[model samples]
Target: MKRRNFLSLGSALAGSALYAGAMPGAAAAGRDRLRIGMIGTGMRGQVLLRELVRRDDVEVAALCDIEPIMLGRAVQMVTAAGKPAPATFGENGDGYAYRRMLDSGKLDGVIIATPWEWHAQMAIDAMQAKVPVGCEVVAGVSLQDHWNVLDAQLKTGTPYMLLENVCYRRDVLAVLRMVRSGLFGELVHLQGGYQHDLRAVKFNSGDPTKPYGGGVEFGAKGWSEARWRTEHSVRRNGELYPSHGIGPCAMYTNINRGNRFTRINAFASKAAGLHDYVVRNGGEDHPNARTRFQLGDIVTTTLACDNGETIILQHDTSLPRPYSLGFRVQGTRGLWMDLNRSVHVEGISKPHEWDDARVWFEKYDHPLWRKYGEQAAGAGHGGMDFFVIHAFIEALKENAPMPIDIYDAITWSAITPLSEQSIALGFHTLDFPDFTGGKWRTRKPIFAFDDRY
Candidate 1:
């Protein structure tokens, strides 16, 4: 895992094609339907399973998870959808059971919904096994993990897509259309962040009936995300979950396509929210109250781009607040802010007055949404999940490049480690790694370029 010079490595590897074409066993090669596999059947994994089962073009070929209860629940879901029971693994506490599923030679592609730490290794294993991968957010924990995953894909020529659904959000896509069409004019500064209250999610009771709140427990006593996600908050002080915020922003600026993040500096506020929540909800004398959390209540990171646009991101999950990504896209002529759902233009809007963004969003709604809005309904995360999954399937079926390719995946996920490095060094600005090997200068924008995907 020694750090290799990406600039030189990218230069050496730049000539090779990076498109995600059909693999040897892909459905694109004469198969009637896709044979897919599921890696984790937890709460989030179940949501993905529901979406997969509903797709007529896909079959849940295999399932894996350490918890049998979750595995049973997922089995019930597939059966309820009328799909055949998929081969199940991980029931015997084998952490590497997923590797067996990948080696089974029954999968066309795999969707990884496992915990964050497992994402990198599973993806690497899938690529090495020549299985196409649609992995959930934060591709890897360390910067080297990103490089390793990228290297695996380059060596094996396997398709890998980061299931970053926020990039397909209705308003976010609409703004993307606007940005491409010059509605926002020349892009200047943009802001987005994961600024939602997750105090309850960070500490959930193990009770099945009351899974989210009603208790202050984590690790063995916690449920779902509480079991693992809270551990990161307790050990790290950076933008732990940044893809939701940076994904759409990267799309707007064409990050890792024609532009790239050059450098970044991050600042973190003193830690207080998690402990305060425990004291207020669970008594101060609660055993968990004594646990120290390292994650800041609010972490702000500023990134400079090679294209002259500056991006700011904030991570604020421990505090109490209504959910909002805090998205703001500004340019020389106009700006859009998701916090207030308002937009302002130099001439289209009144003199320095804000206009309802709904009008503009409706006018420029992405073709993909306009065409598949009905189909996307009821899918998780306000229906964006359907689009992300659809993109993966369609790309694999067509043997075309992924809309969100490996370069984009690593660049977006690299923010977490880079932000951590910056904060650990007294908010020092650090040069961003060029994961694309300087190929970005010629890479054209494909994400949401049309409704076909």
Candidate 2:
């Protein structure tokens, strides 16, 4: 695709994919339309399902989940679109929804928004079935799951992506511009975290209709309440949730462009509040209580990439605070701590100390900001949700490389569990997995959504 035309496609398809380089009128077959099925109907799944249904070039042909109620809800949505309602699967049993969707010749790909643990397995299953897959990330739920998926991708010869949507955030695009344009000279250290207070949400593992917190864990195996956390407690670090904070940071460091994380060391707070709250809140207290969560409530994960630049990723969900994922990137020249407080060559510390971060950061009058700034700057998480979905679809339709790929997905997700291991140990430094076999640095950069940079 031509350079200008590539950008045009990105802005056009929004967040879906198409067969790029094909003849203009060749994308006519129903198969060319890229039929997609959704697995898992929870929070994340619902969002992706709703989002994809809006794209005219795509069709959702399957909706699957263990819970009949959720499946029914999704079916209602499909009917509302005036499209054929999806064939529901996994009404009972282990709920192999992805596999069920892949069985249909009508589906060319699947989007998995299942719990983190099932992500790898479902993705691999889809690939094996010769279906393209877009999976939710935090990397893989298990070390072995990671290995299996990578191998599967290479073997199946299908497009596989971990949806690290945060790469499309508005402020994030601004940061990328700074990096590509050399505003943040040689960004050496970056900081990010997904610190939300999920300690209070009540979940029931035996029942999918209830809150999704209790009695669920992600691993090579699917959701298991067997460990007993689901029966009566909360668990963290069991799944290593990453797709949130890690997404944007990975893009900033150019993980796909060969900047790889060389090492990481991390620590987690001792399990306290969640466990105590579970026991206090009528959760069954039993022998496994001691074994329930060795993971700390607060986990501070540090990443050191091959470029010798490190990014700090923190996940603290046990705390009872307002939802926040601090995306802080610091370079030798200028540093940005939040949405506003950016210090290029002057007044860096002043902005950091002030309240109302936007008061200092919002530069609505800036040229780049003025150009592609309004809707996104105020959209989901400052309009990032829209930007990311939009960019992904356009790139797929154009057959352009996505900014976040499997390589980025692996490294970013790997940090969570790897750092958990580090924190489990006495803060020992562990060599980060070479997801790309160490060839990451020599790769050419892909076009970022923010062309202004």
Candidate 3:
């Protein structure tokens, strides 16, 4: 049932008034089943689907994607677990299948893995419909998608969360505990980076054999070949794809906590050896081939928060660099960096200490993760995906604030587009709009809801 219908049903049961406590049957049948639908289930969609299926309290009531191929695997995933076959639909016929399904079903919430451009549009529609939303990547395509979610959430009174999964990393969570305990003191500045090479993970026109046709998160029959990057590239020049690289640190510094971003400047390098390598590696006759990459090889951005704290962000897609996201946080007392898959803390008479991500989990001799962590670990990003979704589901069941709340999302996602615009305007300082209207000042911390601590 819709939120309105649910509310009215409660009113009818209790004649003229309602109490802080629940009515008879209302308390018996709790909100155990949350009717949910998913949009954009490509690779990332599959990751979230695995997480959603684990909980007995929720079910994937509906599934929508642009291609039947994408939905097939997701369908098999949920059903193979003994759940009934969901009411499945595909926009393979049209790109708007997600919208049509939203109108037809009674969805309590939605998990959108749709492309960056559509992030704001679909999420806004879900919020307007009074459906809680958990979305991936970009907060808004332009100013409109950004402000629309803010207004819609306020007007309709629904939860709008950005599905930034990194905040749930076990090591990151342990780091938060350390920070909360003041192990990392008065963080003054930090650095974040998302560097990956997809040269082997070819896109539509990007491959020589044309193995897979163009159809991504925002699927459509003929979605202009050049439309790819607009949906994917996190940093045009030096914008931080904070969801992955900067996400954990945003939590550490309390981005939406008390300190927030004020302005940023992005500087990108010109075409490098890799650009020429990709070109020379391919013959001149590669049709519809890449001309000049807008997101040059490497990009660097510098941000200063309201508290006079600074953060350095770096982005790169070329070169055979190691697979890693550079994370560094510096404080008045000490500094922390994870460079070689090991965190190093220093700034003392003696170097603080260095520990691998495993060290934190080692002490988890406590079995919170052992029973639940195995299969999710078998799935994606060493199971961080499950951690994020688990946090979201528990929040709904308990009426607690979201771990990655709307403000957290807006603060992190805002960096992408603004960084692009900053590079476009030649590093001129651009204002980072606070979509929260400043309510972040007093809002409770969302992650504290975790009972595991």
Candidate 4:
């Protein structure tokens, strides 16, 4: 039934009576069936949609996108999956269509994969409507938006997750198990970053005729376009996309639980990569050719945790570099380095030498992967996406708190804006906000590698 007609019927037959009949209990929620709505039918959204509907327990009840083509494709995918075609809202002028779906009372939750700017607002609105939200990464673009999301989650007590797939990576999770088991010893320092080259994607004047395409070359595509990401290259100076690297590091370091970031200082290399690319390809007369990108080719952010450990975060996408999270976990006993896929355990190995960590990865393979890795291998991003979605759905069906909760989402995303402020001010040490308000000190870790899972 449509929400409007349902509301009318409820008004005709007493409000409380209707609501009581419609709302389900914890027992019902735990029954494995979860009806969900998806917002933003872009490539990322479509990829997740394919993963989500693969489960018999999940139903894509609704879809929202600005473009009809994208919305139609999603509808077809759902119907092709032997599920009923989902209701769709494609009016892109304003995002009231998203709000309408939230108010419809048909969804158990919503998955948001909209562009970076819309992430905070969409998740906030879903939580405000008393619906759980599983959103894509970079929780917010600005620091205030980060606080906005935190406030909304706190105010509503609704489940909010960042959907950081990297945390579920097989190797990363294996390393996580080692960290928890004292294989890494007392965690002393760590480093990670989003260092993948996105120049082609950032500069790809997206085709406008196809679904998720429709942006003028070298111009902002209103709100939804490849220009949105590229525009960040022209304006921001800090870790623009930090979650991919920071999420796993935060998990391994027990951030927002036992350890909290206290302060940060950042430095940026000169902005040359993007401009140089534009000039080398498109002449000096091109719009981006002469434009001075505020974002440096390489931005390095150093953070100090309240527990006295240090973290180094690097953003090096604009330049020519191979994809690497650069995940480095160091402790009193040993270290795990992603670049070399090696580990150095003090007593287990020769003095001051690194040994292949592949052995440890195999021996300490995370329980989740040991069981489901073969199954998860079918999904995208080397199967990391599968585990991320699986974790969220499992938590939701069981009515447990999200594995990557609101505090983790906000804390990791806030690094971007904080780093920007630090870099702009001559690398001044900026104090990090305690979003947990000291609860981190007492809150036990919820994201642990369980053999039972």
Candidate 5:
């Protein structure tokens, strides 16, 4: 249990803890290999498991899923990796088995990667049990859910991290470095969105024998992992997936630091894209065609921050479009745009023009990326996924503060329910819930941009 260098575990485990000091049990398990439990081994869960299984100092001690097939697949994966087959839990109705797994008293932490609805409850249970949690992004289904998760972490003093891998993207981190260095002086506004073409993914039910979106399906059954996601689209209207856009932007603009989102006004375009796609592929009489989806093909959300900055976020996925987050960070001195890969800085470039962003990327790429870029590139989502998982593992090994703490998780996830309320009230201004409880005013930024191991 002696304190040891986290990097000594391995290169994959090597990374900065950012904030120093260990969590409640860091020293107790310092020498012992970290034992992590996996919850919800669906599509995304499997991807994370694969990355985790590749690590040497970590052990996938347990796996949980409602679906027996998914759980078996994950178990098979652990065995295939020539590692010990992890203990398995599945489908005891009403999440009973998941809670039982938590009570097993066998995990340093549990990673929740289930459908959207399950994240809040699972995280609450884990923290209450004095176990740290690393949950996948998008906090929960509603603003209140975010508050509950936030309250749990605060009350229990347990660490909770939102797995926002996009924040680890090389370019995004580079942008963060510049933001912190005053390269983008006096941050005035920021914009980003989840603009992927999810037409097929939203409709896919994971039934390989049954074609979905007129093609072979993959992963879990019923419409995109438990049918919850499609139901979310059918029932709600707002920025359903906001973290991918707001996560990195929040860091760049220093949310929970000097800046906090104060008010939000959102508008949703008419919902037509999903219905049209369903009819085109499955005919007008198809079940999905008859379902009236409230979610818009395009949702524009505007957020006002306490630091005199405004953020514009968009949710565009139901319609045909190429994948792009449409990340844009602007300030008095310079601006960056992701789609075109361009950047412009006052006094550093021609007047009112953009130079290739690659120039800046090559020159000012984040030190983490510069060192681990090749390894990360071999992982998912252009290597952002690798760093995110790596950072989480290291945090557990060191028992240090989480990279994406509960405050960031709730703030980014709360946007969904807040936007829904705003849209329902005809784009009326709604105050953002202060999950930090005013600590943002004095709390030092926990996310460090310094280069280190």
Candidate 6:
């Protein structure tokens, strides 16, 4: 489809209240089966494909990937599910093969799970093709890339959602309910982070059979994420992956809906984790051990919001540590910390003591989880992946605006580049751009506002 034609169609679709308010059952009179496409059929793409095929309302119409092995595996998965074989792209290793899929007029929507650098341009092309997008984390690598995406969505009026599943995590959602119910009592400060060791994920043998943790190889000599993800550690210094931590925190503080981040400051520890891993796993004589990694072993960023709430986010992926988002939601009355799974209420608990968070989580489990917990079993990421993907497909079928919309996508992603700039300037604070263009003052929180998918 031509860009101009798609823009007109998108504008007309926008006029039909597609981007307005939620209208349950609105799309029942529309299509009975939605046609979906997959881009970057790597490990993450395979997981999403598994969930998509599990649904009766979705048809896996097309698949695209530069890697022939991954693409073939995805096709086999669909056919094994008793669905028709999807049209495949990128057999010849053309990076732009996704453009052909987008222009094929066969896809109602596209789910992107490509490397970090390719996210923005691919999403822009999909939106311009009049296809809704459910994109993976970190919308763009640069600040201007984010603005460009925002401009494309604004101009085309296409639906774009960040496939950030962490926001729907059971305990996170429970804490969100607590915040909204005034249990937190006027939010003050919050903290969350990507504090997991990724040494094994960053290095692997090029052989697909040994997908992870057998050798210290990256870039062209690695498989799956190790092929691309580790290169960022060698070339950049920033909070490269921020959505997993910031998405839920944004919900708690109402970011981009009557609240927005205004400024940010960041700091980074010395770069040693990746190099140490290389030396430990492959010895000092390994070629990768001599490669200078620019990314810090630990990166910390602090953000100030318009509503006086403060947020601290840490990016600590290269070190040795158990996985944790290290969430701490504090307010006037009390606080909840995920690190120890404990909560403290000024009067609810014994003075200066902790209560097991499990009781609180059970008492206030998210309504959506309570309703779909059984169905979500076996879905990735503790079944939160089911919720995020469900929200995308349901919104498409209902013709409603996405729960986590374009503004939310860029707002969370812009943190990476902004943090890099902050760290470059010796931990100096920088102004956070308002991607909503002043609409944040009036925009309302729609994420997980109801139990409906």
Residue pairs with backbone overlap in model 3:
none
Per-prediction TM-score to the true structure, in the order listed: 0.93, 0.79, 0.82, 0.90, 0.91, 0.94
Candidate whose TM-score is highest = 6
Candidate 5 per-residue lDDT, tens place, 22-72, comes to 366765655446889989987789888988898887899999987776788
Per-model root-mean-square deviation over C-alphas? 5.6, 6.5, 8.8, 10.4, 6.1, 6.8
Q: Sort by lDDT, best first: what order?
A: 6, 1, 5, 4, 3, 2
Candidate 6: list runs displaced more than 4 Å: 1-20, 23-25
Which parts of model 1 are misplaced by more than 4 Å?
1-31
Q: Which model, 3 or 4, shows the larger TM-score?
A: 4
lDDT of 5: 0.80
lDDT of 1 by residue, 321-352 (tens): 99999999998789999999999988889997
Clashes of 2: 15
Winner on lDDT (1 vs 6): 6
Best-performing candidate as measured by lDDT: 6
What's the CA error at residue 112 for candidate 4, in Å? Answer: 0.7
Better of 1 and 3 by TM-score: 1
lDDT of each: 0.86, 0.61, 0.63, 0.80, 0.80, 0.89
lDDT by residue (1-453, candidate 3, tens digit) is: 221232233223222211121234532444777877898767678788887887788888998886676678789988998887777777455777777778874887889986667778888788776778888867876656667766777787687777776666666655555554444556677877777664433234433233243322111212322234433432345463656776877766666655677788888787463445445555455422354446656778788877677887777765567766777766655555667545444553347556664664354322335446665666467777776677567556655456577777777777777887888887788887876678646443334312331
lDDT of 2 by residue, 1-453 (tens): 222222233344322222112234322422335577888876567766666676676778888888676678788877787778778888874566456568777775677876667778888888888877777665475677777888888787766767766665546655654555555566678887877776534323434444444542322221322222232223445225666887777666666454667778887667776566555543455433343655567778777766667787777766567777788876666666663444443344444343343533353222334454564454345545544555455445544444466666676777666765776577888887887775664554443333321
Q: Candidate 5 or 6, higher lDDT?
A: 6
lDDT of 2 at 200: 35
Q: What is the lDDT of residue 163 in candidate 5?
A: 93
